[model samples]
Target: MAGLDWQGWLTIGVVLATLALLLWERFSPDKVLIGATVVLAGSGILGVRQALAGFWNPGVLTVAVLFVLVAALKSTGAIRWIGDWVLGRPRGEFAAQARLVAITSPLSAFVNNTPIVAMLTSAIEHWSRRSGVAPSKLLLPMNYATILGGMCTLVGTSTNLIVAGLVHQQPGMPALRMFDPLGVGAVAAVAGGIYLLTVGRWLLPLRRSALQQATETREYVVEMLVEDAGAMAGMTIGQAGLRGLAGSYLVELVRNGELHAAVSPEEALRGGDRLVFVGATDAVRELRRLSGLRPATEQLFKIDDAGGRRTLVEVVLSAYSPAIGKTLVEATFRSRYNAAVIAVARHGTRLHGKLGDVVLQVGDTLLMETDAKFLRRYGNRAEFLVSNEIDGAARVDRPRALVALGVVAAMIVANTVLGVDILLSAVAAAALVLLAGCVHVAELRRSLDLRLIVVIACSFALGAALDRSGVAALVAAHLMGWAGSDPFWTLVLVYVAAVAFTELVTNNAAAVLMFPIAVSAATQLGVQPMPFVIAIMMGASAGFITPIGYQTNLMVYGPGGYRFSDYVRVGLPLSLVVGVSVLLAIPRLWPF
Candidate 1:
């Protein structure tokens, strides 16, 4: 107390205000953390190098590189393949959850959980459509599974790597190994997994995703031809994952000029077989992305070779349109506009027969496959009243999937077996992915989550301010006083504080802020700092009670259509299970 200075007090105040703003949701976390870092840097509490050091931190750079690596995997269909293979044809919801947790946990152990969640969210949604399970039933469990998996390894989540980086800076403190947390983290994951699969499963509400809840105002009848050499050519309808589609149904299958209505799930698909589907706009959009299928019209091939640069555009025919009364075949829509009408909807009515025979009318909405430049060229044209590109409808490079997977595997081997640093391994892997043409440079740039990286980088500045200003020591003294010289109780207090901070702020920021205090507490007790450090690492990731607590939680929030109380209902108990398991295991593995 006697050593406390004005700098310490200012850092404390700034941290409190930052936390308040974060909890208040007044601004994004990057802005809040950056604002606090600026204040501390301006006050000379931290030098420019220290304030900006996080940007160059190995952990932060590794995170950025991993984003590109994951993007490559996603772009090349490696992730979707993994999901489909692992989550294969589960009979019921329980089996689905079990399979999901089984795969997500282990995969998340190596990859960053954010992109994993993002990629798998869509996959699981599509799976739900086919399996007759509600997305709300699966998304939360999957999110939690990723969090639990993240705890088992240092690279599993950014929080663990950030803490390890902070530990490396401390004199005499040993750096964390890849599997240092495995002892406690594995136990906690098992316990948490059991709870989520059993009691937690029952606690989840049977809800629909935002897309499912929306009314289908524009139902389009789309015809897709099975490609002769594609993966789905010889597979049964059910085997090809076309059996059950949410908000959409197969109306008929046209084979050899014969119409097969009420298509059976066991029907075998042949090359050039035309499958007709009636679905809402969202469902149609998803259908466009399916592999082994193309728009049934030959006009699509006549468009200029956009190749991977093609996108889906939705436009409403205006009264002044030249082909308002003409059929698409007569209008030569593809040649004139350099686009193909994949599907069309008129006044919410399902148009039957061939798409080319449909007469264009005023107010008809046409979903067209066109060059990426379509929107910019036609946005203000009188021929269309509305023109917009469908988001997330990009061409996937399935051919390079194996290359992306191989690169990831090599990176893991280099990092874990060959004694290379994770940042170098990640950089090499990302580079290899680009060099192999798994993902384009533009896609790589877009995949980097700058907001998350900024929040993490700026958080290091706050952590530095806490350590440099002696606030960490002061807080350590208070923590010791609260624990009354008992190391076990002191460990409990540190873990509790970490969990509170994580739930209130964020996983990365919580780990950063708590690192100094955990180390200081270990120092004041004359005990090994590793246990306290491990406590902070595990505790910071145990945030399951609030959506705002974790990025993966928020990612599923809208898609799952969950209430805030939903997390409380299921996550509260799961948190207790994980916390108790971690607290009991940490002291044994890394003895104080």
Candidate 2:
């Protein structure tokens, strides 16, 4: 250990930095990880060749490839095939929704959750509107179901892979066994399902929109200055605290003659960049005056074209969303998919007027309109959250259903059965399915969540540090001492803390920081780590208190006209219910 080279110390330091940024919420995890990689590459911690290894990290690639498979399901309308399987015999609004949750919750075990939400958002909206049940009734469950699904498989979420990867690295440490946490996750999911059916409904926000324009309306547009500002000058919208302006938002920061790459929450704002803020008409106007900014575009609001063949709406992207951190240009959103972006809102910043140059990122709200054909054609191209609730039947493409099912199935089989890493299988399946004409090559680009890539890549670097820096091990040791030999207590400490942390930062970030602690705890107890890990996976999804917790919740917060308390009112109970469920099931499935 004393003889470890500069590369070892550098690698360890980089990983420690990754954990610090995420755990402390000091800086953007993506930014921290990317910077760490460059630094580590320079020090030869992972070697010049291995430094880029993160780019090829199976977890990162699996997430990206899964995007394409999900897109194919959405594009081909194969997801629709499964709709009947879940929603066919709805007992009532509550029961039907519960059933939907039950089915989707399980499927998420095999795949990621963003596409599941994208595939369902419209359908749920349409179902609620048609049945006269509030969409608030279904959405919380949708988010919960997807989250629970993520707990079932290692490849389901990047968090799981991070845990598996790190644990495997420790000498004598166990690599994750298939279905190790399945029992615990299933129990948690079940308890959560019941809780959602019961107390969860009371906690959800009620929001529905009949008019497309009213729903899609860009909040407000204001102009901000980048002149001589410290952080703002070098910062992007995300980095400039502009995205933090939740209630009111800034659209874009205009610099001399050029729009920035994308309005990332982590992006640095540069001096002389004219910032555009979009929020409530009143808030937008007021913030402009406060910030000494002006409007870059005239009044723009959404128009309801749902009744007609054409429509306009806004979409908020989830962290896992394929649309994270890519512009319409790279995804060819307009030409290939045939939709136009009239404006974009990254919380406080509003991207309007010059749409073509704007790069997109997760959590950025997009305002656009197109005909039914255009939506139908391009809907599967990008994984965007419904910033504005959409009104229509969740469209289906029967021709693409087989492709979707086969590709997804092949991926799962490749990972679990064939001993291939899930990511490799997913990439291969996506490529083969697309080349085989199941999905278009163009669709692949549209489905990637590039920002997520950045986040995952960075998280991996952090995972390295958690192990090397002795931080994760230390934390685990502490928790084990406190929780003692009680498996229940251990689960409580790991799972409960995971839920709390995720609500504060991103889930991927939360897992990276907490995983080492869980590993350490397992070591202290001299018991297997599976049960404790199940706790983290379930806990990360427990962010139900505020719109800020999960991107899904944030996407719905304003759109639902939900107050911060609304999440607490509903999400708290759901969190507990899920928590209890994990306790009951994990012991059985992965029995410590």
Candidate 3:
């Protein structure tokens, strides 16, 4: 065995520190990753090019392009339509989960799972309300199903592409075909989905939204407008999906400057009509996203051009605030604060008439759609007791919806059937969407998730350092020593180790770091590396036990109001089921 060199020791130390700090969760993951990358480069453990190569890696760029493409699809309403159409109202929660699995499985195979989850989060929430299912019950399944779906195809997740990249790097190793991993991946997904539907549903945490969480404040009053020629225009209140909404009521309607008290459910809505609703904050947020309904305020339009840069912030009035004693109209919130109030929540109090006429008081929580700079400008001010930005909802562009769908279809066909390079196809598809008016040049920058991109890029440096310094080989030798020379058991060890690392680190990082180690173990055993490689790919993406392990898990974390234990309760078993399924199927499908 080779003794540990200085570079190997340094690389090991850096990797350990990064893992420790990540578990601490005090700093951003990107900062920690970049810091480690710089350390490896500065210590001469890795060349500058090797350290920065991740930034230009095809895997990283493919993920970035897919993010933008998904954004175009989202903003154009393509994803929403697909969700509604495929996941038709099911009679029960189990059926709803099954429907979601059916829809997400196929879609995620062709698209990246991050945007697939992002697009489905809201749709699932809405479905839960309409179908009497808890969002908690459905959301975790949605995330898991998407992860499972990603395993079925080479282009499904960035992790798969990273594995494919490594496969291409090894001399004499054939490039992975698009469907090379499909058999094992598909089996695992189906088994995992079945597990979730039966045993997993009972284990899901029944978390209530913050709005409904407190009995002291059961509801809040808000207003919405019927858009011109929208889904709700000319429809009676009963027909506009305003009736029978759980824990919500359409209280009144204002039209032509006249207040119509307790407007009958039979009254048809017009473009100019203002509808008053009494509901929990969660329901009102869902209302904001329904097709053809918008906030009644004209101020929201002023900042719509900012693209995705705008966010929703919760601001509480303080006793000393200048706006506390005045109405929102009198305070000129849009002008003074550079934000528009979308909704307000006050304790057990009923708000009457127009939102502009409501008098502000200390402790009133205002839900405002603010500019990117709003939090920085007002976050610390004594005038507001609290100013925190929350997740803003996605908006749809009806005009460009079909164009986005067409571009996605073309990319899938060109890559899978026509044998075009996946990266080239993705780039072309992204370009086509932008030119076809599905997304604008100005909006393109906002679509990228820079934090995810940065972390992924830096992980390449870490992976290279591990490989070049012989640390991966050292670890593999030790692992093989414990596995007793059985290649199949060694494959299981590789998979379990990858899964452990994935739960601790990011999925892409886990895959990148494990690829060399898996190959080394296979080489040591004098067996084919494809089984170990396939194991790494499956295990790395199966990060179900924790939110930090996967982006999609965190995406649904806050929106679903999930506790950390919630994920563990449901995801732990799902992970085990997937692991066993993958282990049983990989060797049969591809003998070592």
Deviating ranges (above 4 Å) for candidate 3: 214-399
- Each candidate's TM vs. the true structure? 0.72, 0.69, 0.73
**Per-residue CA lDDT of candidate 2, range 1-592, in tens?**
4645555566566655555565554445566678877786565444565545556665566566667777677667676556545566565777877787878888878766666665566566556656767656676677777777777778666677766655555578566754655666667677777777776766666654222223455544345565574444654554445544534544333457554322445656555566644444565545544442344454322244355443555566544444445656566664443444555655334544334456666556565554445454445433555533355555566656776687678777776787875556767887876875766767666656676778766666555555655656666666666777676787788887788778877787677667777877777777887677767766776676766677567655423334566677877777777777666767767667
lDDT for model 3, on a 0 to 1 scale?
Answer: 0.75
lDDT of 1 by residue, 1-592 (tens): 6687899889999999999998875465778989998999999999999999999887888787888887787667676576667667889999999998888888888777866776677677667766779988998999999999999888899888888788777888776677778888899899999999999999999876544442232345557899999888999998988744654556456688765544566889999998866555555666677899887764222211223444555566654467878877588676577665655655333354456567887556665665666644554354664454544343355679888888888987887788788778889988888888898876666556677789899999989999999999899889999999799999999999999998888888899999999888889899999999999999999999987677677667655667778999999999999988888988788898
Clashing pairs in 3: none
**lDDT value, residue 529 of candidate 2:** 76
Give the lDDT of residue 284 in candidate 1: 62
What lDDT does each candidate get? Answer: 0.77, 0.61, 0.75
Model 3, range 428-545, lDDT digits (tens) per residue?
Answer: 9988987887876545665566777898889888888988999999999888888897998889899999999999977888998898899989999999999999999999999999
> Model 1, residue 406: what's the lDDT?
87
Query: After superposing candidate 2, which stretches have Cα over 4 Å from the reference?
Result: 1-29, 39-53, 80-92, 167-178, 208-303, 317-384, 387-395, 410-428, 484-491, 584-592
**Model 1 / residue 7 / CA error / Å:** 0.9
Worst 10 residues of 2 by lDDT: 207-216
Q: CA RMSD for every model?
A: 13.9, 10.8, 12.5
* TM-score ranking, high to low: 3, 1, 2
